[model samples]
Target: MNTLLTSLPKSTPLPRYATRLLGAALSATAYAVCLPWDLRNRAETAGAINETSPVTALGVTFLSLSLLSLAAYFGIRDRLSWTLLVVAAPPATLLYASLSSHPTQDANAWPVAWAFFTLVLGAGVLVAGSVARQFGPRAR
Candidate 1:
């Protein structure tokens, strides 16, 4: 008697689309939500975004590249660099978020809610990235 299940692969990958799109989207959204809010206050947003002032700006660029790499990763498996970029994005974005937000409003306010969403999305991407094995292309 065969006990094998055909639907499941030996690979323990996160859903490829979720990891690729969600990770990049979360990183972008987090930066979108937090960066402007901080800047609007006329504060030096960099101070709150972690690391040296110049480095935080660099991190923003890095996350943006990471997101683009996630798209690129979907198209080409030959380049190992895309994997690193996608993998690195969540933590870097989260680091910026954690440092940037000051919670000027009530805890339940829209800004706060949006910020929280960004955090959850960023963290979820990290969790998903750990397990993502890029499955869909094979299914096709």
Candidate 2:
């Protein structure tokens, strides 16, 4: 099991373009899912009906699944996947917004979340550059 776990990253190597496109798609999906939730939350906070619709629940479920998938995909590698990192950004942004808007019992936790988000975004940029370098023309 340990050997299989160690070899997982080597088993799934995606191309640069594919990675970028997938990342963009995933990010867009995350944004789409979160937007409605955000709007609903705002409406509720303004004393509107606080109802849990099935669609909202499903959207949240999808968001959770995407986050989990991203973590698992990126966790296996020494070098993170830029696509997965991009996928992580929206949810992280939502987390930041949540933390900022309502200070919970543990307001101090936001900094750690912020740091993690920064790290993921930074790693995405670095890995993207590395992937881009591989696209250069080869010598004869």
Candidate 3:
């Protein structure tokens, strides 16, 4: 049993808070970049600036893939609390976008669908992380 264990590859453990920071940073960066495009697309569609395009769907897919991957990586190597930290990025960024976009307007200009999608995506991230943790290697 000892020899078998010795022959297996070892992975470096992530430091505490590493997952939290990395996950949040990745999520925030993704949202910062994608949200602007999403907003522009929505505004144009509403104003009839041009016909709608596939960019919106592509952006959403990209965000989903990237965020889910980040969550899974954290879940496989770190605790669940750290993985959950990723969920905070969406609302924080959304608030920033809202205030910056329309400080005087009483109504929010961003689409409500995205706010709802945040909840759904967050839950998906949690589930992905939880599932990954189940398959991760256990410490001795």
Candidate 4:
């Protein structure tokens, strides 16, 4: 058994950035697919939902994804930069909520909010990864 194990090549783990990127992509895709399904399900079973209901669901999903990503980020060998990425979730969520909410806002604003959230989240992740590469513990 020891001889066979030694003969096999060691599996290499993915880099921190690659994993983070993947997690973000998956989470975004899940959100996209689940949101409409959730809305439809709610409407069919519970009647018309309040304006804030969808938003609240979205927030919960986002928070769950963020926490999962953070947990994955912690497993990486280089954690300094990934910390920034995980830490941005709360503020980003608040910004998303504020921008997407208005008593008088129309349905048109929903698409805009989705786009804005996607862009901001992507940019933040990229920046965090870059900063981690440049100034993280590995740099020293």
Best by TM-score: 3
Off by over 4 Å in 3: 1-14, 37-55, 87-92, 95-100, 103-115
Residue-wise C-alpha lDDT for candidate 2, range 75-116, written one tens digit per residue: 442244443455566656655665466424423566787778
lDDT of each: 0.44, 0.50, 0.60, 0.46
Clashing pairs in 3: none
Tens-digit per-residue lDDT, 11-82, candidate 4? 234443454565545544544443422322223345444443454666656754664454334323334445
> 1 or 4: which has the higher lDDT?
4
| lDDT tens digits by residue: candidate 1, 6-33 | 2222324455434445645654564554
- Candidate 4 has its poorest 10 consecutive residues by lDDT at 2-11
The TM-score obtained by model 1 is 0.27
Instruction: State the lDDT of candidate 3 residue by residue for 1-140, as single tens digits.
Output: 33222211233344344435656777877766654433333434565534343346777777778777777777776566656665455545664564456323345544564567556776887899888777665533
In candidate 1, position 61 carries an lDDT of 62
Q: How close is candidate 2 to the true structure, as a TM-score?
A: 0.38
Among residues 3 or more apart in sequence or in different chains, the pairs in candidate 1 whose N, CA or C atoms overlap within 3 Å are none
- In candidate 2, position 129 carries an lDDT of 39
Rank by lDDT, highest first: 3, 2, 4, 1
lDDT of candidate 2 vs native?
Answer: 0.50
Model 2 collision count: 0
